[model samples]
Target chain A: MTSLTLNAIVSQMAAIEQFTNNILKILEQDARTTPAQIAVMTGRTEQEVKDQIAALEQKGIIKRYKTVIDWAKAGRERTYAFIDVKVTPSRGVGFDDVAERIYKYPEVQSVYLVSGEYDLRVVVAGTSLKEVSFFVSEKLATIDNVQATITHFVLKRYKEDFEIFEDTSEDRRLSVAP
Target chain B: MKPISHIAKTVPASGIRKFFDIVSQMDDVISLGVGEPDFVTPWRIREACIYSLEKGYTNYTSNYGLLELRKHISTYLNERWGLHYNPENQILVTVGVSEGLDLAMRAILNPGEEVLIPEPSYVSYKPCVLFAGGVPVPLGTTPESGFKVTPEQIAAAVTPRTKALLISYPSNPTGATISREELQAIVDVAREHDLFIISDEIYDRLTYEGHHTAVPELNGAYERTILLNGFSKAYAMTGWRIAYAASTPDVIEAMMKIHQYTMLCAPIMSQMAAIEAIKNCGRECDEMAEEYNRRRRLIVAGLNNIGLDCTIPGGAFYAFPSIKKTGLTSEEFSERLLFEEKVAVVPGNAFGECGEGYIRCSYATGIDQIKIALERMERFVENLGVEGRLKAAGRE
Candidate 1:
């Protein structure tokens, strides 16, 4: 069944039969947190917790789980960069494909299409910008779309992230009654 | 490939840069993206660069930077923000606040430690964190909320792994600022959580509404905070690329080691230019900021008159106006406007997902350019309305 209609969002029938929200939340944070543990915390049966995680995984919300590894100590100097560029013309053509090629360089960390003098500001680093530039000149520039490049090699790094943040009503953290 | 072993293969690129490239090719595009100051580098600052050349100061600075320049930074920070940064060790001169940010990310963030990002923010924060092998958690602050992240918001975003909470006021994209009371409460949360504060006050001097507030102004917050600032926006010297970060001796020592190897030094002449820029920060910063303020009001008022609703940006020279009426996503509106009308604007989604439905219009262009652009925009919108194009184009 596909959700063609918005009303199909939280189906009443789907809400019953072990697809409870509490089990999913528990699984999302710690998929290994036992159904029994979830039952203790969420007041759901162990069977229900197991069923919800299975359902949520099917929904693609509970993607594959992984552990965080500290690789900075594993003999690599992590480098960050912000390279501002002046982009060339890409009218009436598959410009994005060309842009993608330039961005695909192994040295490229990220490529942003920014406003100002630089058309494409890339974020990439290697052992050094020398390594970064080798990829830029040999790989990125050779990608056919890149016109002019100016590298603002990062002399230092301050911050980054990839998690979701939201504002809720009831203040979930405060209402948790910790 | 000099393959960066041990790092995650995937690093996210900012969606905004693509639009910037698109707008660059089109003629007559007046841009408000990029969060750059509209004014040219103050004459004093520019003259300083020329002066440095005349003096032939063309050698690399000491790894930490010119002693005189560091002194000026310490003095500037103390006078402006009432904070003390030891010139000898607590401060390390960087290429720009961009580099200062990178250094901090390198120094403090070990893999898997959480660094909380408050958005819509400068495009750099999240990418920098991820590259450092740290996990980035974003906190969304909306326009309805003046884009200010509250203490409660900070607390909710924290997990046990949360090593740092960020504060960027006179912010980019949103132009939202934090009140002292609100900041103090955030400081309290950091103390409770035992988290560090990464304070980005790059927009510190351009605050039009009132005096700027820093998380470092609070008692314990300064000790636990890494201060990042630069001459880019404030001094209108983005090209010169001189900025620095301030922290305790231990943290700075850690960062300086990374910086020395990463970038042996910022351009020698750029440091010379910064020495002059800092000494003349008083009038040089104010004159350009005042002009930016005038342009800021004009653009905001004009956008509103043209039927694009925009909130008053308290600081920075950008007015982010919602283009929902134009019935275009930030990209569609920006692209068509560039190709058809020749007006350049950055789509809001470039900053974060929340920035969708809006476009960042920089007031950095001349008053005449803004006025003409506004007139063209009014015509564009009116024409779209008459043709029933905007609404029909799937814009609500």
Candidate 2:
């Protein structure tokens, strides 16, 4: 009997989910940070950082280079939300087929499959919760495979991977409990 | 990426949203697609909001909302609309008519419950119903029965799991309202089935024919009905986001718990403005309604003149006309009219399946703009070249 090592099983799973988001963990961050700096942070070779980015790019995972705007400065300073959705596939269709149909909606910034009663989740932005609910129901729930949905509005986001690029170097104080 | 959550993955996109996005991209589009008041917030209401801000009253109130706002809502409903509610216990001020609809469903629905939703309704009802973990079983209505929810249709749609029957009069998309007599029949069916009623009366004050009746005021309904009304339509305060739900304490209490966890309360200023709206500006609200009625007549009469026979609406600011004679789908005709004629009316299908071969044209605009829209629509009709284009002329 052949035995698969733990690392081998993990690598196999990671390979499939690699498209979910590249594990560009510990990417160069310091404005003074570069491929050379990341190499120093992770104790990898300077050339290795460049090679990993190139590999990720070749695999079509690194889609584009983008800039982050401060949300307050961007005139979108209001509360942001994420709506968790569950769709009933139209016409006896399965989740994949129905999701494929709905994810194509313009208001949907992101889409995912979730655990529990609902099979899918969506991220959307709107001026207000009423606007968000309007989008989910009037827009998303009307689609096939959206049998039902439960929306968990973000109360406050303590962590956001793409934004809040602070390293916790400063003494951060909160008057109210986060 | 495992995507984000269950909700993001499952629900489909909204048709109205998709249409708005498309329309937003087009040049020279005059959209009657949006179902909101065109008038700005009345001066008295705006002054009231300013007064609240000047007084520096800008903190979150009780989860149910400011006590005075609720008291005003309670009194306003009773004094004007003939409905009764307890300020402290039976009312939950909400984000808008939109949130009140959601709160009603959230409070009522158990998982897998079915909501008997009437078709050609305001776009939000079905989705709001579904979001509360209820299934929306759409009961189709038509011009034949004045587009009101027929008692027979309600009986056919109800099942054991049917938790609520949603009733929206002076309905959006369809522009229909039920008579007091007609409502009594449906009320009988709802009582027999032990079903709850979620009556939406946002357009209650805009009626052209007669005064709107409050179902909750009817015999035995005050206990079961969750009546949702708002100042948006009446006061032209779309952005104010103040609406309230009047119901039994159990329902309002359940809604308040959810409202506290979620919304907290409606904007402090909006509630304050609403207090003045109910207290001071009754005539100002009616002036906007009267203007809409004028444009309603202009559009409906013009459409009839040009061969689109419409069910002249009794309340609300819309005219629903049949487009069958045009030989184009509601989507196609509206799209063509947008580009070629520079007029935008929402497709009937934007409302529901039964909304096919019809269109909802809001008269929420000036008479001059209504005139321009009508003339351009007449040209579009003449050019459709459908065999029955002239058939509509006879129906008029």
Candidate 3:
């Protein structure tokens, strides 16, 4: 009876692995792959695909779908910069409090507690280099516990999130070929 | 009217062209027809090309391609498959494997000589042989054996005028991979008959179950093998049109002569990019292959679940599901699937006669599209009635 229970547990684990692994992979590759479409791909019924996706969402595993856009190609003029900050860790919370405060601003795209000379690396985006500089000099540098800052404005984006920006090659594949 | 040559006139247009035309006119059709990756070329590789362009690399490379690119390819092949070829004389870059195949056939084949080709394979192989004034002898492989060519089939197909054995493992339509032992058997047969081997390994990097065995790596096979590989499938550099053929010096020189007169060289920008790709893009290629493997599992399971009787392919991104239960030929099934459900998969018969009862669905598209397509196909299959479903399940 114990062995039988173990077998059931093992099979249940296998089922969970199958469901989660397949759904996560599909979603990660293209989050746009809808529940209905995922159902067909994974051999699950539409309802099952929906249930698994909903469960994943409820569990906070499925986050959000993002479009990889080449802003340069779209003729959108924008400035991006990476600001490395030397921060004094708070007594009780260490870098968490400072990192959290820096990330609250709309312009601060991402903040990370990084190693090396700088403690926090904040990535900020703005309409112009001047605006980004202003944000860094005024808001970012003035934040409590921020000791110093180093700003590196991004000159050009060759790539972002696995998408190559300036590729001229057209897809030459035939619609149907052996 | 322009005067078409006799050979050109005799060669039939690709059977898929009409379907492509129809597909082009339709809207909202989810296609699993194309045999190319959905991913673009990795950014670092594209950046290398852009850097090359900025540095003014617009000029044509040598007819044999850049020495740097060749050396990298040589190192890559040696490291990956334990195959060695002199970059100076044994490798010639061509405009993708398409041109390499043509060059190899033209370089070796005499008029009316036969190249034994496994059927339901790449569409280009037979036509390339025909255009080169060589006969293509079809060696039929079946779904029963996972579409792999057997030693018996190869032995039976060999005849007096047979010049070479042309094979593409991790095959396109069927997504079958020939094992190292199986390939060794074929190599033995080739040696017995004293025939050359033309191996297209474009999909070498996409294998899931086992590592691909380059035919030239087999014992007694290296000297007589013309190995064709390209960056198109592996690196998602299809449009860059870079491929190389490695062979004995004599074959390479012969192919180079034709290549010089016809192609001149592969694009210089692409060559520079390829150098970067071979040097730096191993992790990206592995990630893409892993993604494809996941999709492969999903699509295979979905097909089998839908009662299509699909064999789980060992490599390549296609799922060659048998559609025989619909009581329709491959063409009928493909047409109905496209029109009724708005899901387009190539009729398997487009590959060859042996592909009659199946359809080739590529899992290279987004999982969402694959899922949607599967749903539509399942609905279509269910509407075929209980008898059809039973027949597909092999219980009828």
Top-DockQ candidate index = 3
Scanning candidate 3 chain B in windows of ten residues, the lowest lDDT window is: B383-392
Could you tell me how far off, in angstroms, the CA of residue B135 lies in candidate 3 after the best superposition? 1.2
The stretch of ten residues in a row with the least summed lDDT in candidate 1 chain B is: B26-35
Question: How much does candidate 1 score in TM-score?
Answer: 0.66
Q: Against the true structure, whose TM-score is highest?
A: 3
Q: Considering DockQ, which of the candidate structures 2 and 3 is the better prediction for this target? A: 3
Instruction: Give me the runs in candidate 2 sitting further than 4 Å from their true place.
Output: A1-178, B4-7, B386-396
Instruction: Give stretches of model 3 more than 4 Å off.
Output: A1-111, A114-174, B1-3, B386-396
Candidate 1 on A38-73: residue-level lDDT in tens? Answer: 554444576876777788779887777765333355
> What digit string (tens of lDDT, one per residue) describes model 3 on residues B241-295?
9999999999999999999999899989989999999999998998798778768
Query: For residues B283-369, what per-residue lDDT tens digits would candidate 1 score against the true structure?
Result: 768767756765676677788878999888888777888889766788888777777777777777777778889888877766667
lDDT of 3 by residue, A42-135 (tens): 6578898888888888888877667766566689888999999999877875798888888999999899887898998999999898999999
lDDT string for model 2 (A1-178, tens) is 1356877888778743432222253331223235653443333466866787678779876665555555756777544556666665556687788777766866566778878876777777666778877877787767755677777766665556545444354312110010
Give per-candidate clash totals. Answer: 28, 31, 3
Q: Sorted by TM-score, highest first, which candidate order results?
A: 3, 2, 1
Among these predictions, the greatest lDDT belongs to 3
Docking class of 3: acceptable
C-alpha TM-scores of all predictions? 0.66, 0.67, 0.79
